[model samples]
Target: MKKSTFLVFIIVYLFFSISGFLFPFDSDWYRTLAKPDWTPDGSVIGIIWAILFGFIALSTAIVYQERGFGRHNSEYMSLLGINYILNQVFSYLQFNLHALFATFMDALFITITTLLLIFLAGRQNRFAGWLLLPYFLWTAFATYLSWLFYSLN
Candidate 1:
């Protein structure tokens, strides 16, 4: 992949990462909730997301490099777009709106879409698909956490 193209993907994914800052979590509200003892620290979550976003950007760039936005690869591109949007929207739903159930559902979709992206990317580029494995695992774990939050609180 061209360095410029990869940089662009990194920039776009970084923009999506800003949602956490845009909708900063309500710490006071968060404190009131019944969280599991095993819940990760907020800083840890932030770091994990930062790493995942990097992975996502690289994976996307690889896929785009291998298969541009041609008609034959439209589904791959479409899924990327959808997954990005869904990924950004989770912050608003969870932190801003305080919608636990909705956030849980959003996380669920994110997990599902990540899996689909893995499958699709694998067909085009094995490395790209493998790159998303951490993202998929994290999202699956996140979906479980979301469900726990919804059910516990």
Candidate 2:
């Protein structure tokens, strides 16, 4: 990947990471919830996100390198935009609204969008497609966890 493309990915990753600050963790609310036995702690969540974001940045940079901002890869670009927006929406639902059900549904959207992106990337760059596996697995696991929260609460 070009330096410029990598820079863009870094900017995007930072933007999302910083935006998370807007949603402060509510210990009071969280403590009352009936989470599963295997629910991870805050530190685990942070570590997962850091690794996931790294994968996302690298995958995005790879795609950008393979297909620059051109008409040929417009579909890939569109999926990326959709994934970004839905990811933010999921965060909003989980944090601001504190709506577990809504967050779970939004997570499903994210997982589907990511799967689609993987399918599209596979056509152009197999490496990029394989790179998203960790992301997809994490998001899918998140979706399941969110659903549990919704159902339990």
Candidate 3:
């Protein structure tokens, strides 16, 4: 992949990150819901996403830098980007979109996509793969949260 391609992807990710800032803390219905005791504080969401996206960016860059596996790596990279976008779109549903079921589905898909990227990267590049473990853990936790939210409210 060219530097331009990486730049474009980063720019797009940053756009989602910027959009996240506009979201008010999950209040009203969210607070009223019965969530797990381990459910993360809403205030931490932005920080966690920033850290996850940063690792994702690093893994994407590393994937592009490797030799002899461009084609396969590109597929995972594309999925990562697509899933990341889906993840952001899911957040919008928590606010404006009323499809709690669809939002849950999106969260599940995002978790699967994240798992796929982690598995593929783990096989191809250990560092890239390691970078995503935190994201995978976060998504796993977030998946439960999404399920809980939909279930309770």
Candidate 4:
């Protein structure tokens, strides 16, 4: 990948990642909730998100590289846009609005979008699909976690 493309992807992911900080995790509210025993520690959660975003950035760059700038890649871009928007909404729903069920629904939609992304990207670029595996796995886990949070509290 070109340096510029890589940088753009990184910047975009970081921009979306900023949503978490903007809304901020409500420790007090979270503390009162009935979380599962297996919930990850704060540092671990940070590390996981960092790694997942790294994968997403690289995978998206590959997709862009393969598709190039044109109307041909519109659907791919649209899926990415939807996925990114949905991804941010989860943080807002859980941390800002304190809507656990809405968070789970958003997460479920994010997972489906990620899967669609994998499939669509794979048809043209197999590496892109392979790169998103961790993202898919993490989102799947997140969907379950959100559901657990809703069910418990």
What TM-score does candidate 2 get on C-alpha atoms? 0.92
The stretch of ten residues in a row with the least summed lDDT in candidate 1 is 1-10
Q: What is the C-alpha lDDT of each candidate?
A: 0.88, 0.82, 0.74, 0.85
Question: Per-residue lDDT of 1-153 in model 2, one digit per residue for the tens?
Answer: 578897968976775565367676666777788999999986788788877777777777777787775899899889988988888787678777899989999999999999998888777789879988888998899999999999999
Error of 3 at 123 (Å): 3.2
Better of 1 and 2 by lDDT: 1
Give the poorly placed runs of model 1, Cα more than 4 Å off. none
lDDT of 3 by residue, 1-153 (tens): 787557844864586576476655467756766777877777788788888888887776676666433565577757876886787778777766656777788888888888889887777789978988888888887777788777877
Ranking by TM-score: 1, 4, 2, 3
**Model 4: per-residue Cα lDDT at residue 145:** 88
CA lDDT, candidate 4, residue 46:
70
Q: Write down the worst ten-residue block by lDDT for model 2.
A: 15-24
Cα lDDT tens digits, model 1, 1-153, are 588677768776887688887888778888888989999988799889989888888887887788776898999889988998898899999888999999999999999999999999989999989999999999999999999999998
Off by more than 4 A, model 3 = 1-16, 21-29, 67-72
TM-score of each: 0.93, 0.92, 0.79, 0.93
Those runs of model 2 whose alpha carbons end farther than 4 Å from true positions after fitting are none
